[model samples]
Target chain A: METFSVIFQLLLALSILVVLHELGHFIPARIFKIRVEKFYLFFNPWFSLFKYKKGDTEYGIGWLPLGGFVKIAGMIDESMDTDQMKQPAKPDEFRSKPAWQRLIVMIGGVIVNILLAFFLYAMIAFVWGKDYVKNEDHIHGIEVLTPTLVGDNLFQNGDKIISIEDEPLSELMQANNKMLINQAKNYTIERNGELVNITIQDEGIDYMLKKESIVFIPRVPTQIDSVMPTGIAQELGLKKGDQIQQINGMDVSMFDQFRKELTTMKENNLDSFDLVVNRNGQELAFSSRFDTTYKLGFQNVFFLTHDFKKTHISYSLGQAIPEGIALAQTTLMDYVNQFKLIFTKKEAVKKVGGFGTIARIFPTTWDWKIFWSRTAFLSVVLAFMNILPIPALDGGHVMFLIYEMISGRPPSDKFLEKAQMFGFFILLFVMLYANGNDFYRWFTGQ
Target chain B: MAYYIGVGIAVVIIAFFMAATQKARGYNFWRYFIVSIVVVAGIYMMIENLVLNPK
Candidate 1:
């Protein structure tokens, strides 16, 4: 049921985006008096799944789910209608149109994608508002994940991050993104009741990226809410209200730390471990053996039940428009920055993914707010991707059109055909590589 | 195991497409064959990835 919801949402989002994108081209082609031979929701080769002709244009859904296209007559696109190009250019053909008009037709899809992102973002903001966990609300500080950092005195457990490079952090959730995006040189944290400044080294950044390691997580105390009957914890006489103080002689004051210790013990193949728990006002020590799965069979007190101050920014419909646009702009910039990282950082390339990676972004359980937010983000990504100056893409066509306009001589039919073919090959290679990476990650459990 | 199977299927598909192109174009069969191999290899990698490691 969860998988069904995720797949359904993904397909729905793609359909909406693909239709709008093709419409972007279809509308402009009609305005320029260019004959649109076909507008498809997916690639159609031998036969289309469904198709209908309206006047001059044939609209259809293709069996192949690769992508959709607006087939403008006399254009050297993926359609590869060489016979049509061999004849004289017709009045209504795309080749007969002025360079400026052709440019508009080429860029229309990308423009619509961007506009769609902004609109979706606005609607999402208006409906759900923005909620963030303020940095101050992390009363228990953070559980530092990097063992090397602790060893090197860079960061300590239960360190409250105050600022990065003198800029105060507004939200706890955005700290990691902010740190990476800004490439912070210094971090100020409240540790052991004193403010401490830690210098971030270049090596540290590289390590984090290469390892894909999480630096820290918000700390929560490990308080046992309940123990399953006939399970390891209950069999060992562990009861509710017991606060775990340490695991296997390792001090684990927080739930995160306790879980980490458990994993470490499991990894080391330790079948038994010592546990110290604070019960009522007394500390009790016990040695326990793990079951076959190496689980304690106890549930931690629900984290959300704790009272933590959150910052909420609710916007009126009038205010949402500008805020949404701003959000879209920031999202685009962030995506562009991430794209740059792919080329600059070796590890970033491994993160490139296709449909499988995208599907995982949607929540297992259907939620309208999350669905809309993800769709908006995907729209931004689609717009940026289409605008890249790679042949066979909208950006590639624009690049050629711009060149023709500047040079005052369009490339020959033969040259355009070859370039289109080359672009198609390049795009195919990228898609494969990205999806391959997704598969590799899945198989390796990376 | 699944990855190898995927690659094998992809190679067969590429060979089939190359043969079709060879019949239509009537020359440069080897050139088309090689290009098809590269394209097929790329696509096969993606499909293999999805099949072997679906998240």
Candidate 2:
């Protein structure tokens, strides 16, 4: 069921993006009176799964799911219709069109992709609004789990985060995520009622990403919600409503801290460990044996529970449009900055994910809100990728058209054809490298 | 045996297309058969090195 939902969402999202992207070109080409020979949802090497001809265009779904294409008449695209290039160009053909019209035709897809992203984001906001916790909600301050890399030198327990580089934050967009994504230099924290400035290094940001557990969360108190019937918690006589105060004689205020304590105890091969719990205002000590899973099998009160303070604002349609557009713009800018890290940061290579990783990012169950959110983000990615000035892409075609407009001479048909083929090869190489990384990671259990 | 035949079929298809394109462009005098051989061999080697022999 999980696999089916993932596959279904992936296909639907791709289909929507591909069809709209192709329409971007198709609409312009039609307006310019260019004869579109074919509009395919995917590539058909030997044959198409389904097809129908209407007017001068044949619309079809192809067998290959790699990508979709629109074949324009008199254009030397990946179709390699060199035979038609030998014949005289007709008035309704793409090659016969003016440079300005051709440029519009080339950019149609990218423009549509950008608009689609913004529109989807708006719809998402209007429907789901935004749910978040305020910066003041971290009643026990933020939990820091990375003791090795990001030690107390960077932050102490119970240190209330005030702002990142003078920017106040909530649990939403303008918050911790922005700090990591931007790799901001300094942040302010309220430690002991005194605002102290903490400087962050680049490695600190990278560590936060590599060990995603290190991301700050509201330090929920280690109060037990329920204990398993058959686990060590049962044997240890731990009960519900017990607030665990210490593990291995070390103080542990937060659930995350308690977890780190357990992990370290297991690593040190300590089978027997003790826990101090505040039961009915009595400090009770209990000893327990470590299980293979290194878990005491007890649920703890954490984020999303009634204990953590949360706020949600349901947006009216009128309020959603501008907010959605702002969100979309920020998302694009964030992606662009993060992409730069691929060149600057060495470990960024490991973070690069392909189609498979994308498929897995969706919820295991069919949730329309998350599905639409992911689709919107993907649309932004498609726009950025398609607008790159690489051969065979929309940006590539636009580049040549711009050159033609400025120079008043279009490149030869043979040159265009060769460039298209070269673009296909480059795209193929990139696809292989990305998907191969996915396969490599899966195979090696990384 | 089935896999080899599939590879052979692919080689023939690509070679035929490349050969026909070369001929249609009025390169009939320059031994288009050699182009077919190179295409077939070149594609086969690429598949072997990249797909079959992972390193």
* DockQ, computed on Cα atoms, for candidate 1: 0.13
Colliding pairs, model 2: none
| Runs in model 2 lying further than 4 Å from the true structure | A172-176, A208-214, A247-250, A259-295, A301-307, B1-55
What CA root-mean-square deviation does each model show from the true structure? 5.5, 5.5
Residue A9, model 1: Cα distance from true site in angstroms? 2.0
lDDT of 2 by residue, A1-446 (tens): 88998988998998899999999999999999999988888666556789899999999887656668888888776556787889999999999999999899989999998899889999988998887777787688876655642555587667887888888765522445665678777878888899888886765567765764345656778888999988988788889989999988898867877888988888898888788999999999888678788988889985667365677888889888888889889998888877887787767766677888889878899889999999999899899989888887888888889889999899988889889877865664565456656876787887
Worst 10 residues of 2 chain A by lDDT: A170-179
What are the Cα lDDT values of the candidates? 0.80, 0.78
CA shift of A267, model 1, Å: 12
Please give the DockQ score of every candidate, comma-separated.
0.13, 0.09
TM-score, each model? 0.83, 0.83
- Residues A190-274, candidate 1: write the lDDT tens digits: 8888899888665444666877765666777888888988787888788888989988889887887888888888898999888
- How far residue A218's Cα lies from its native spot in candidate 1, in Å, is 0.7
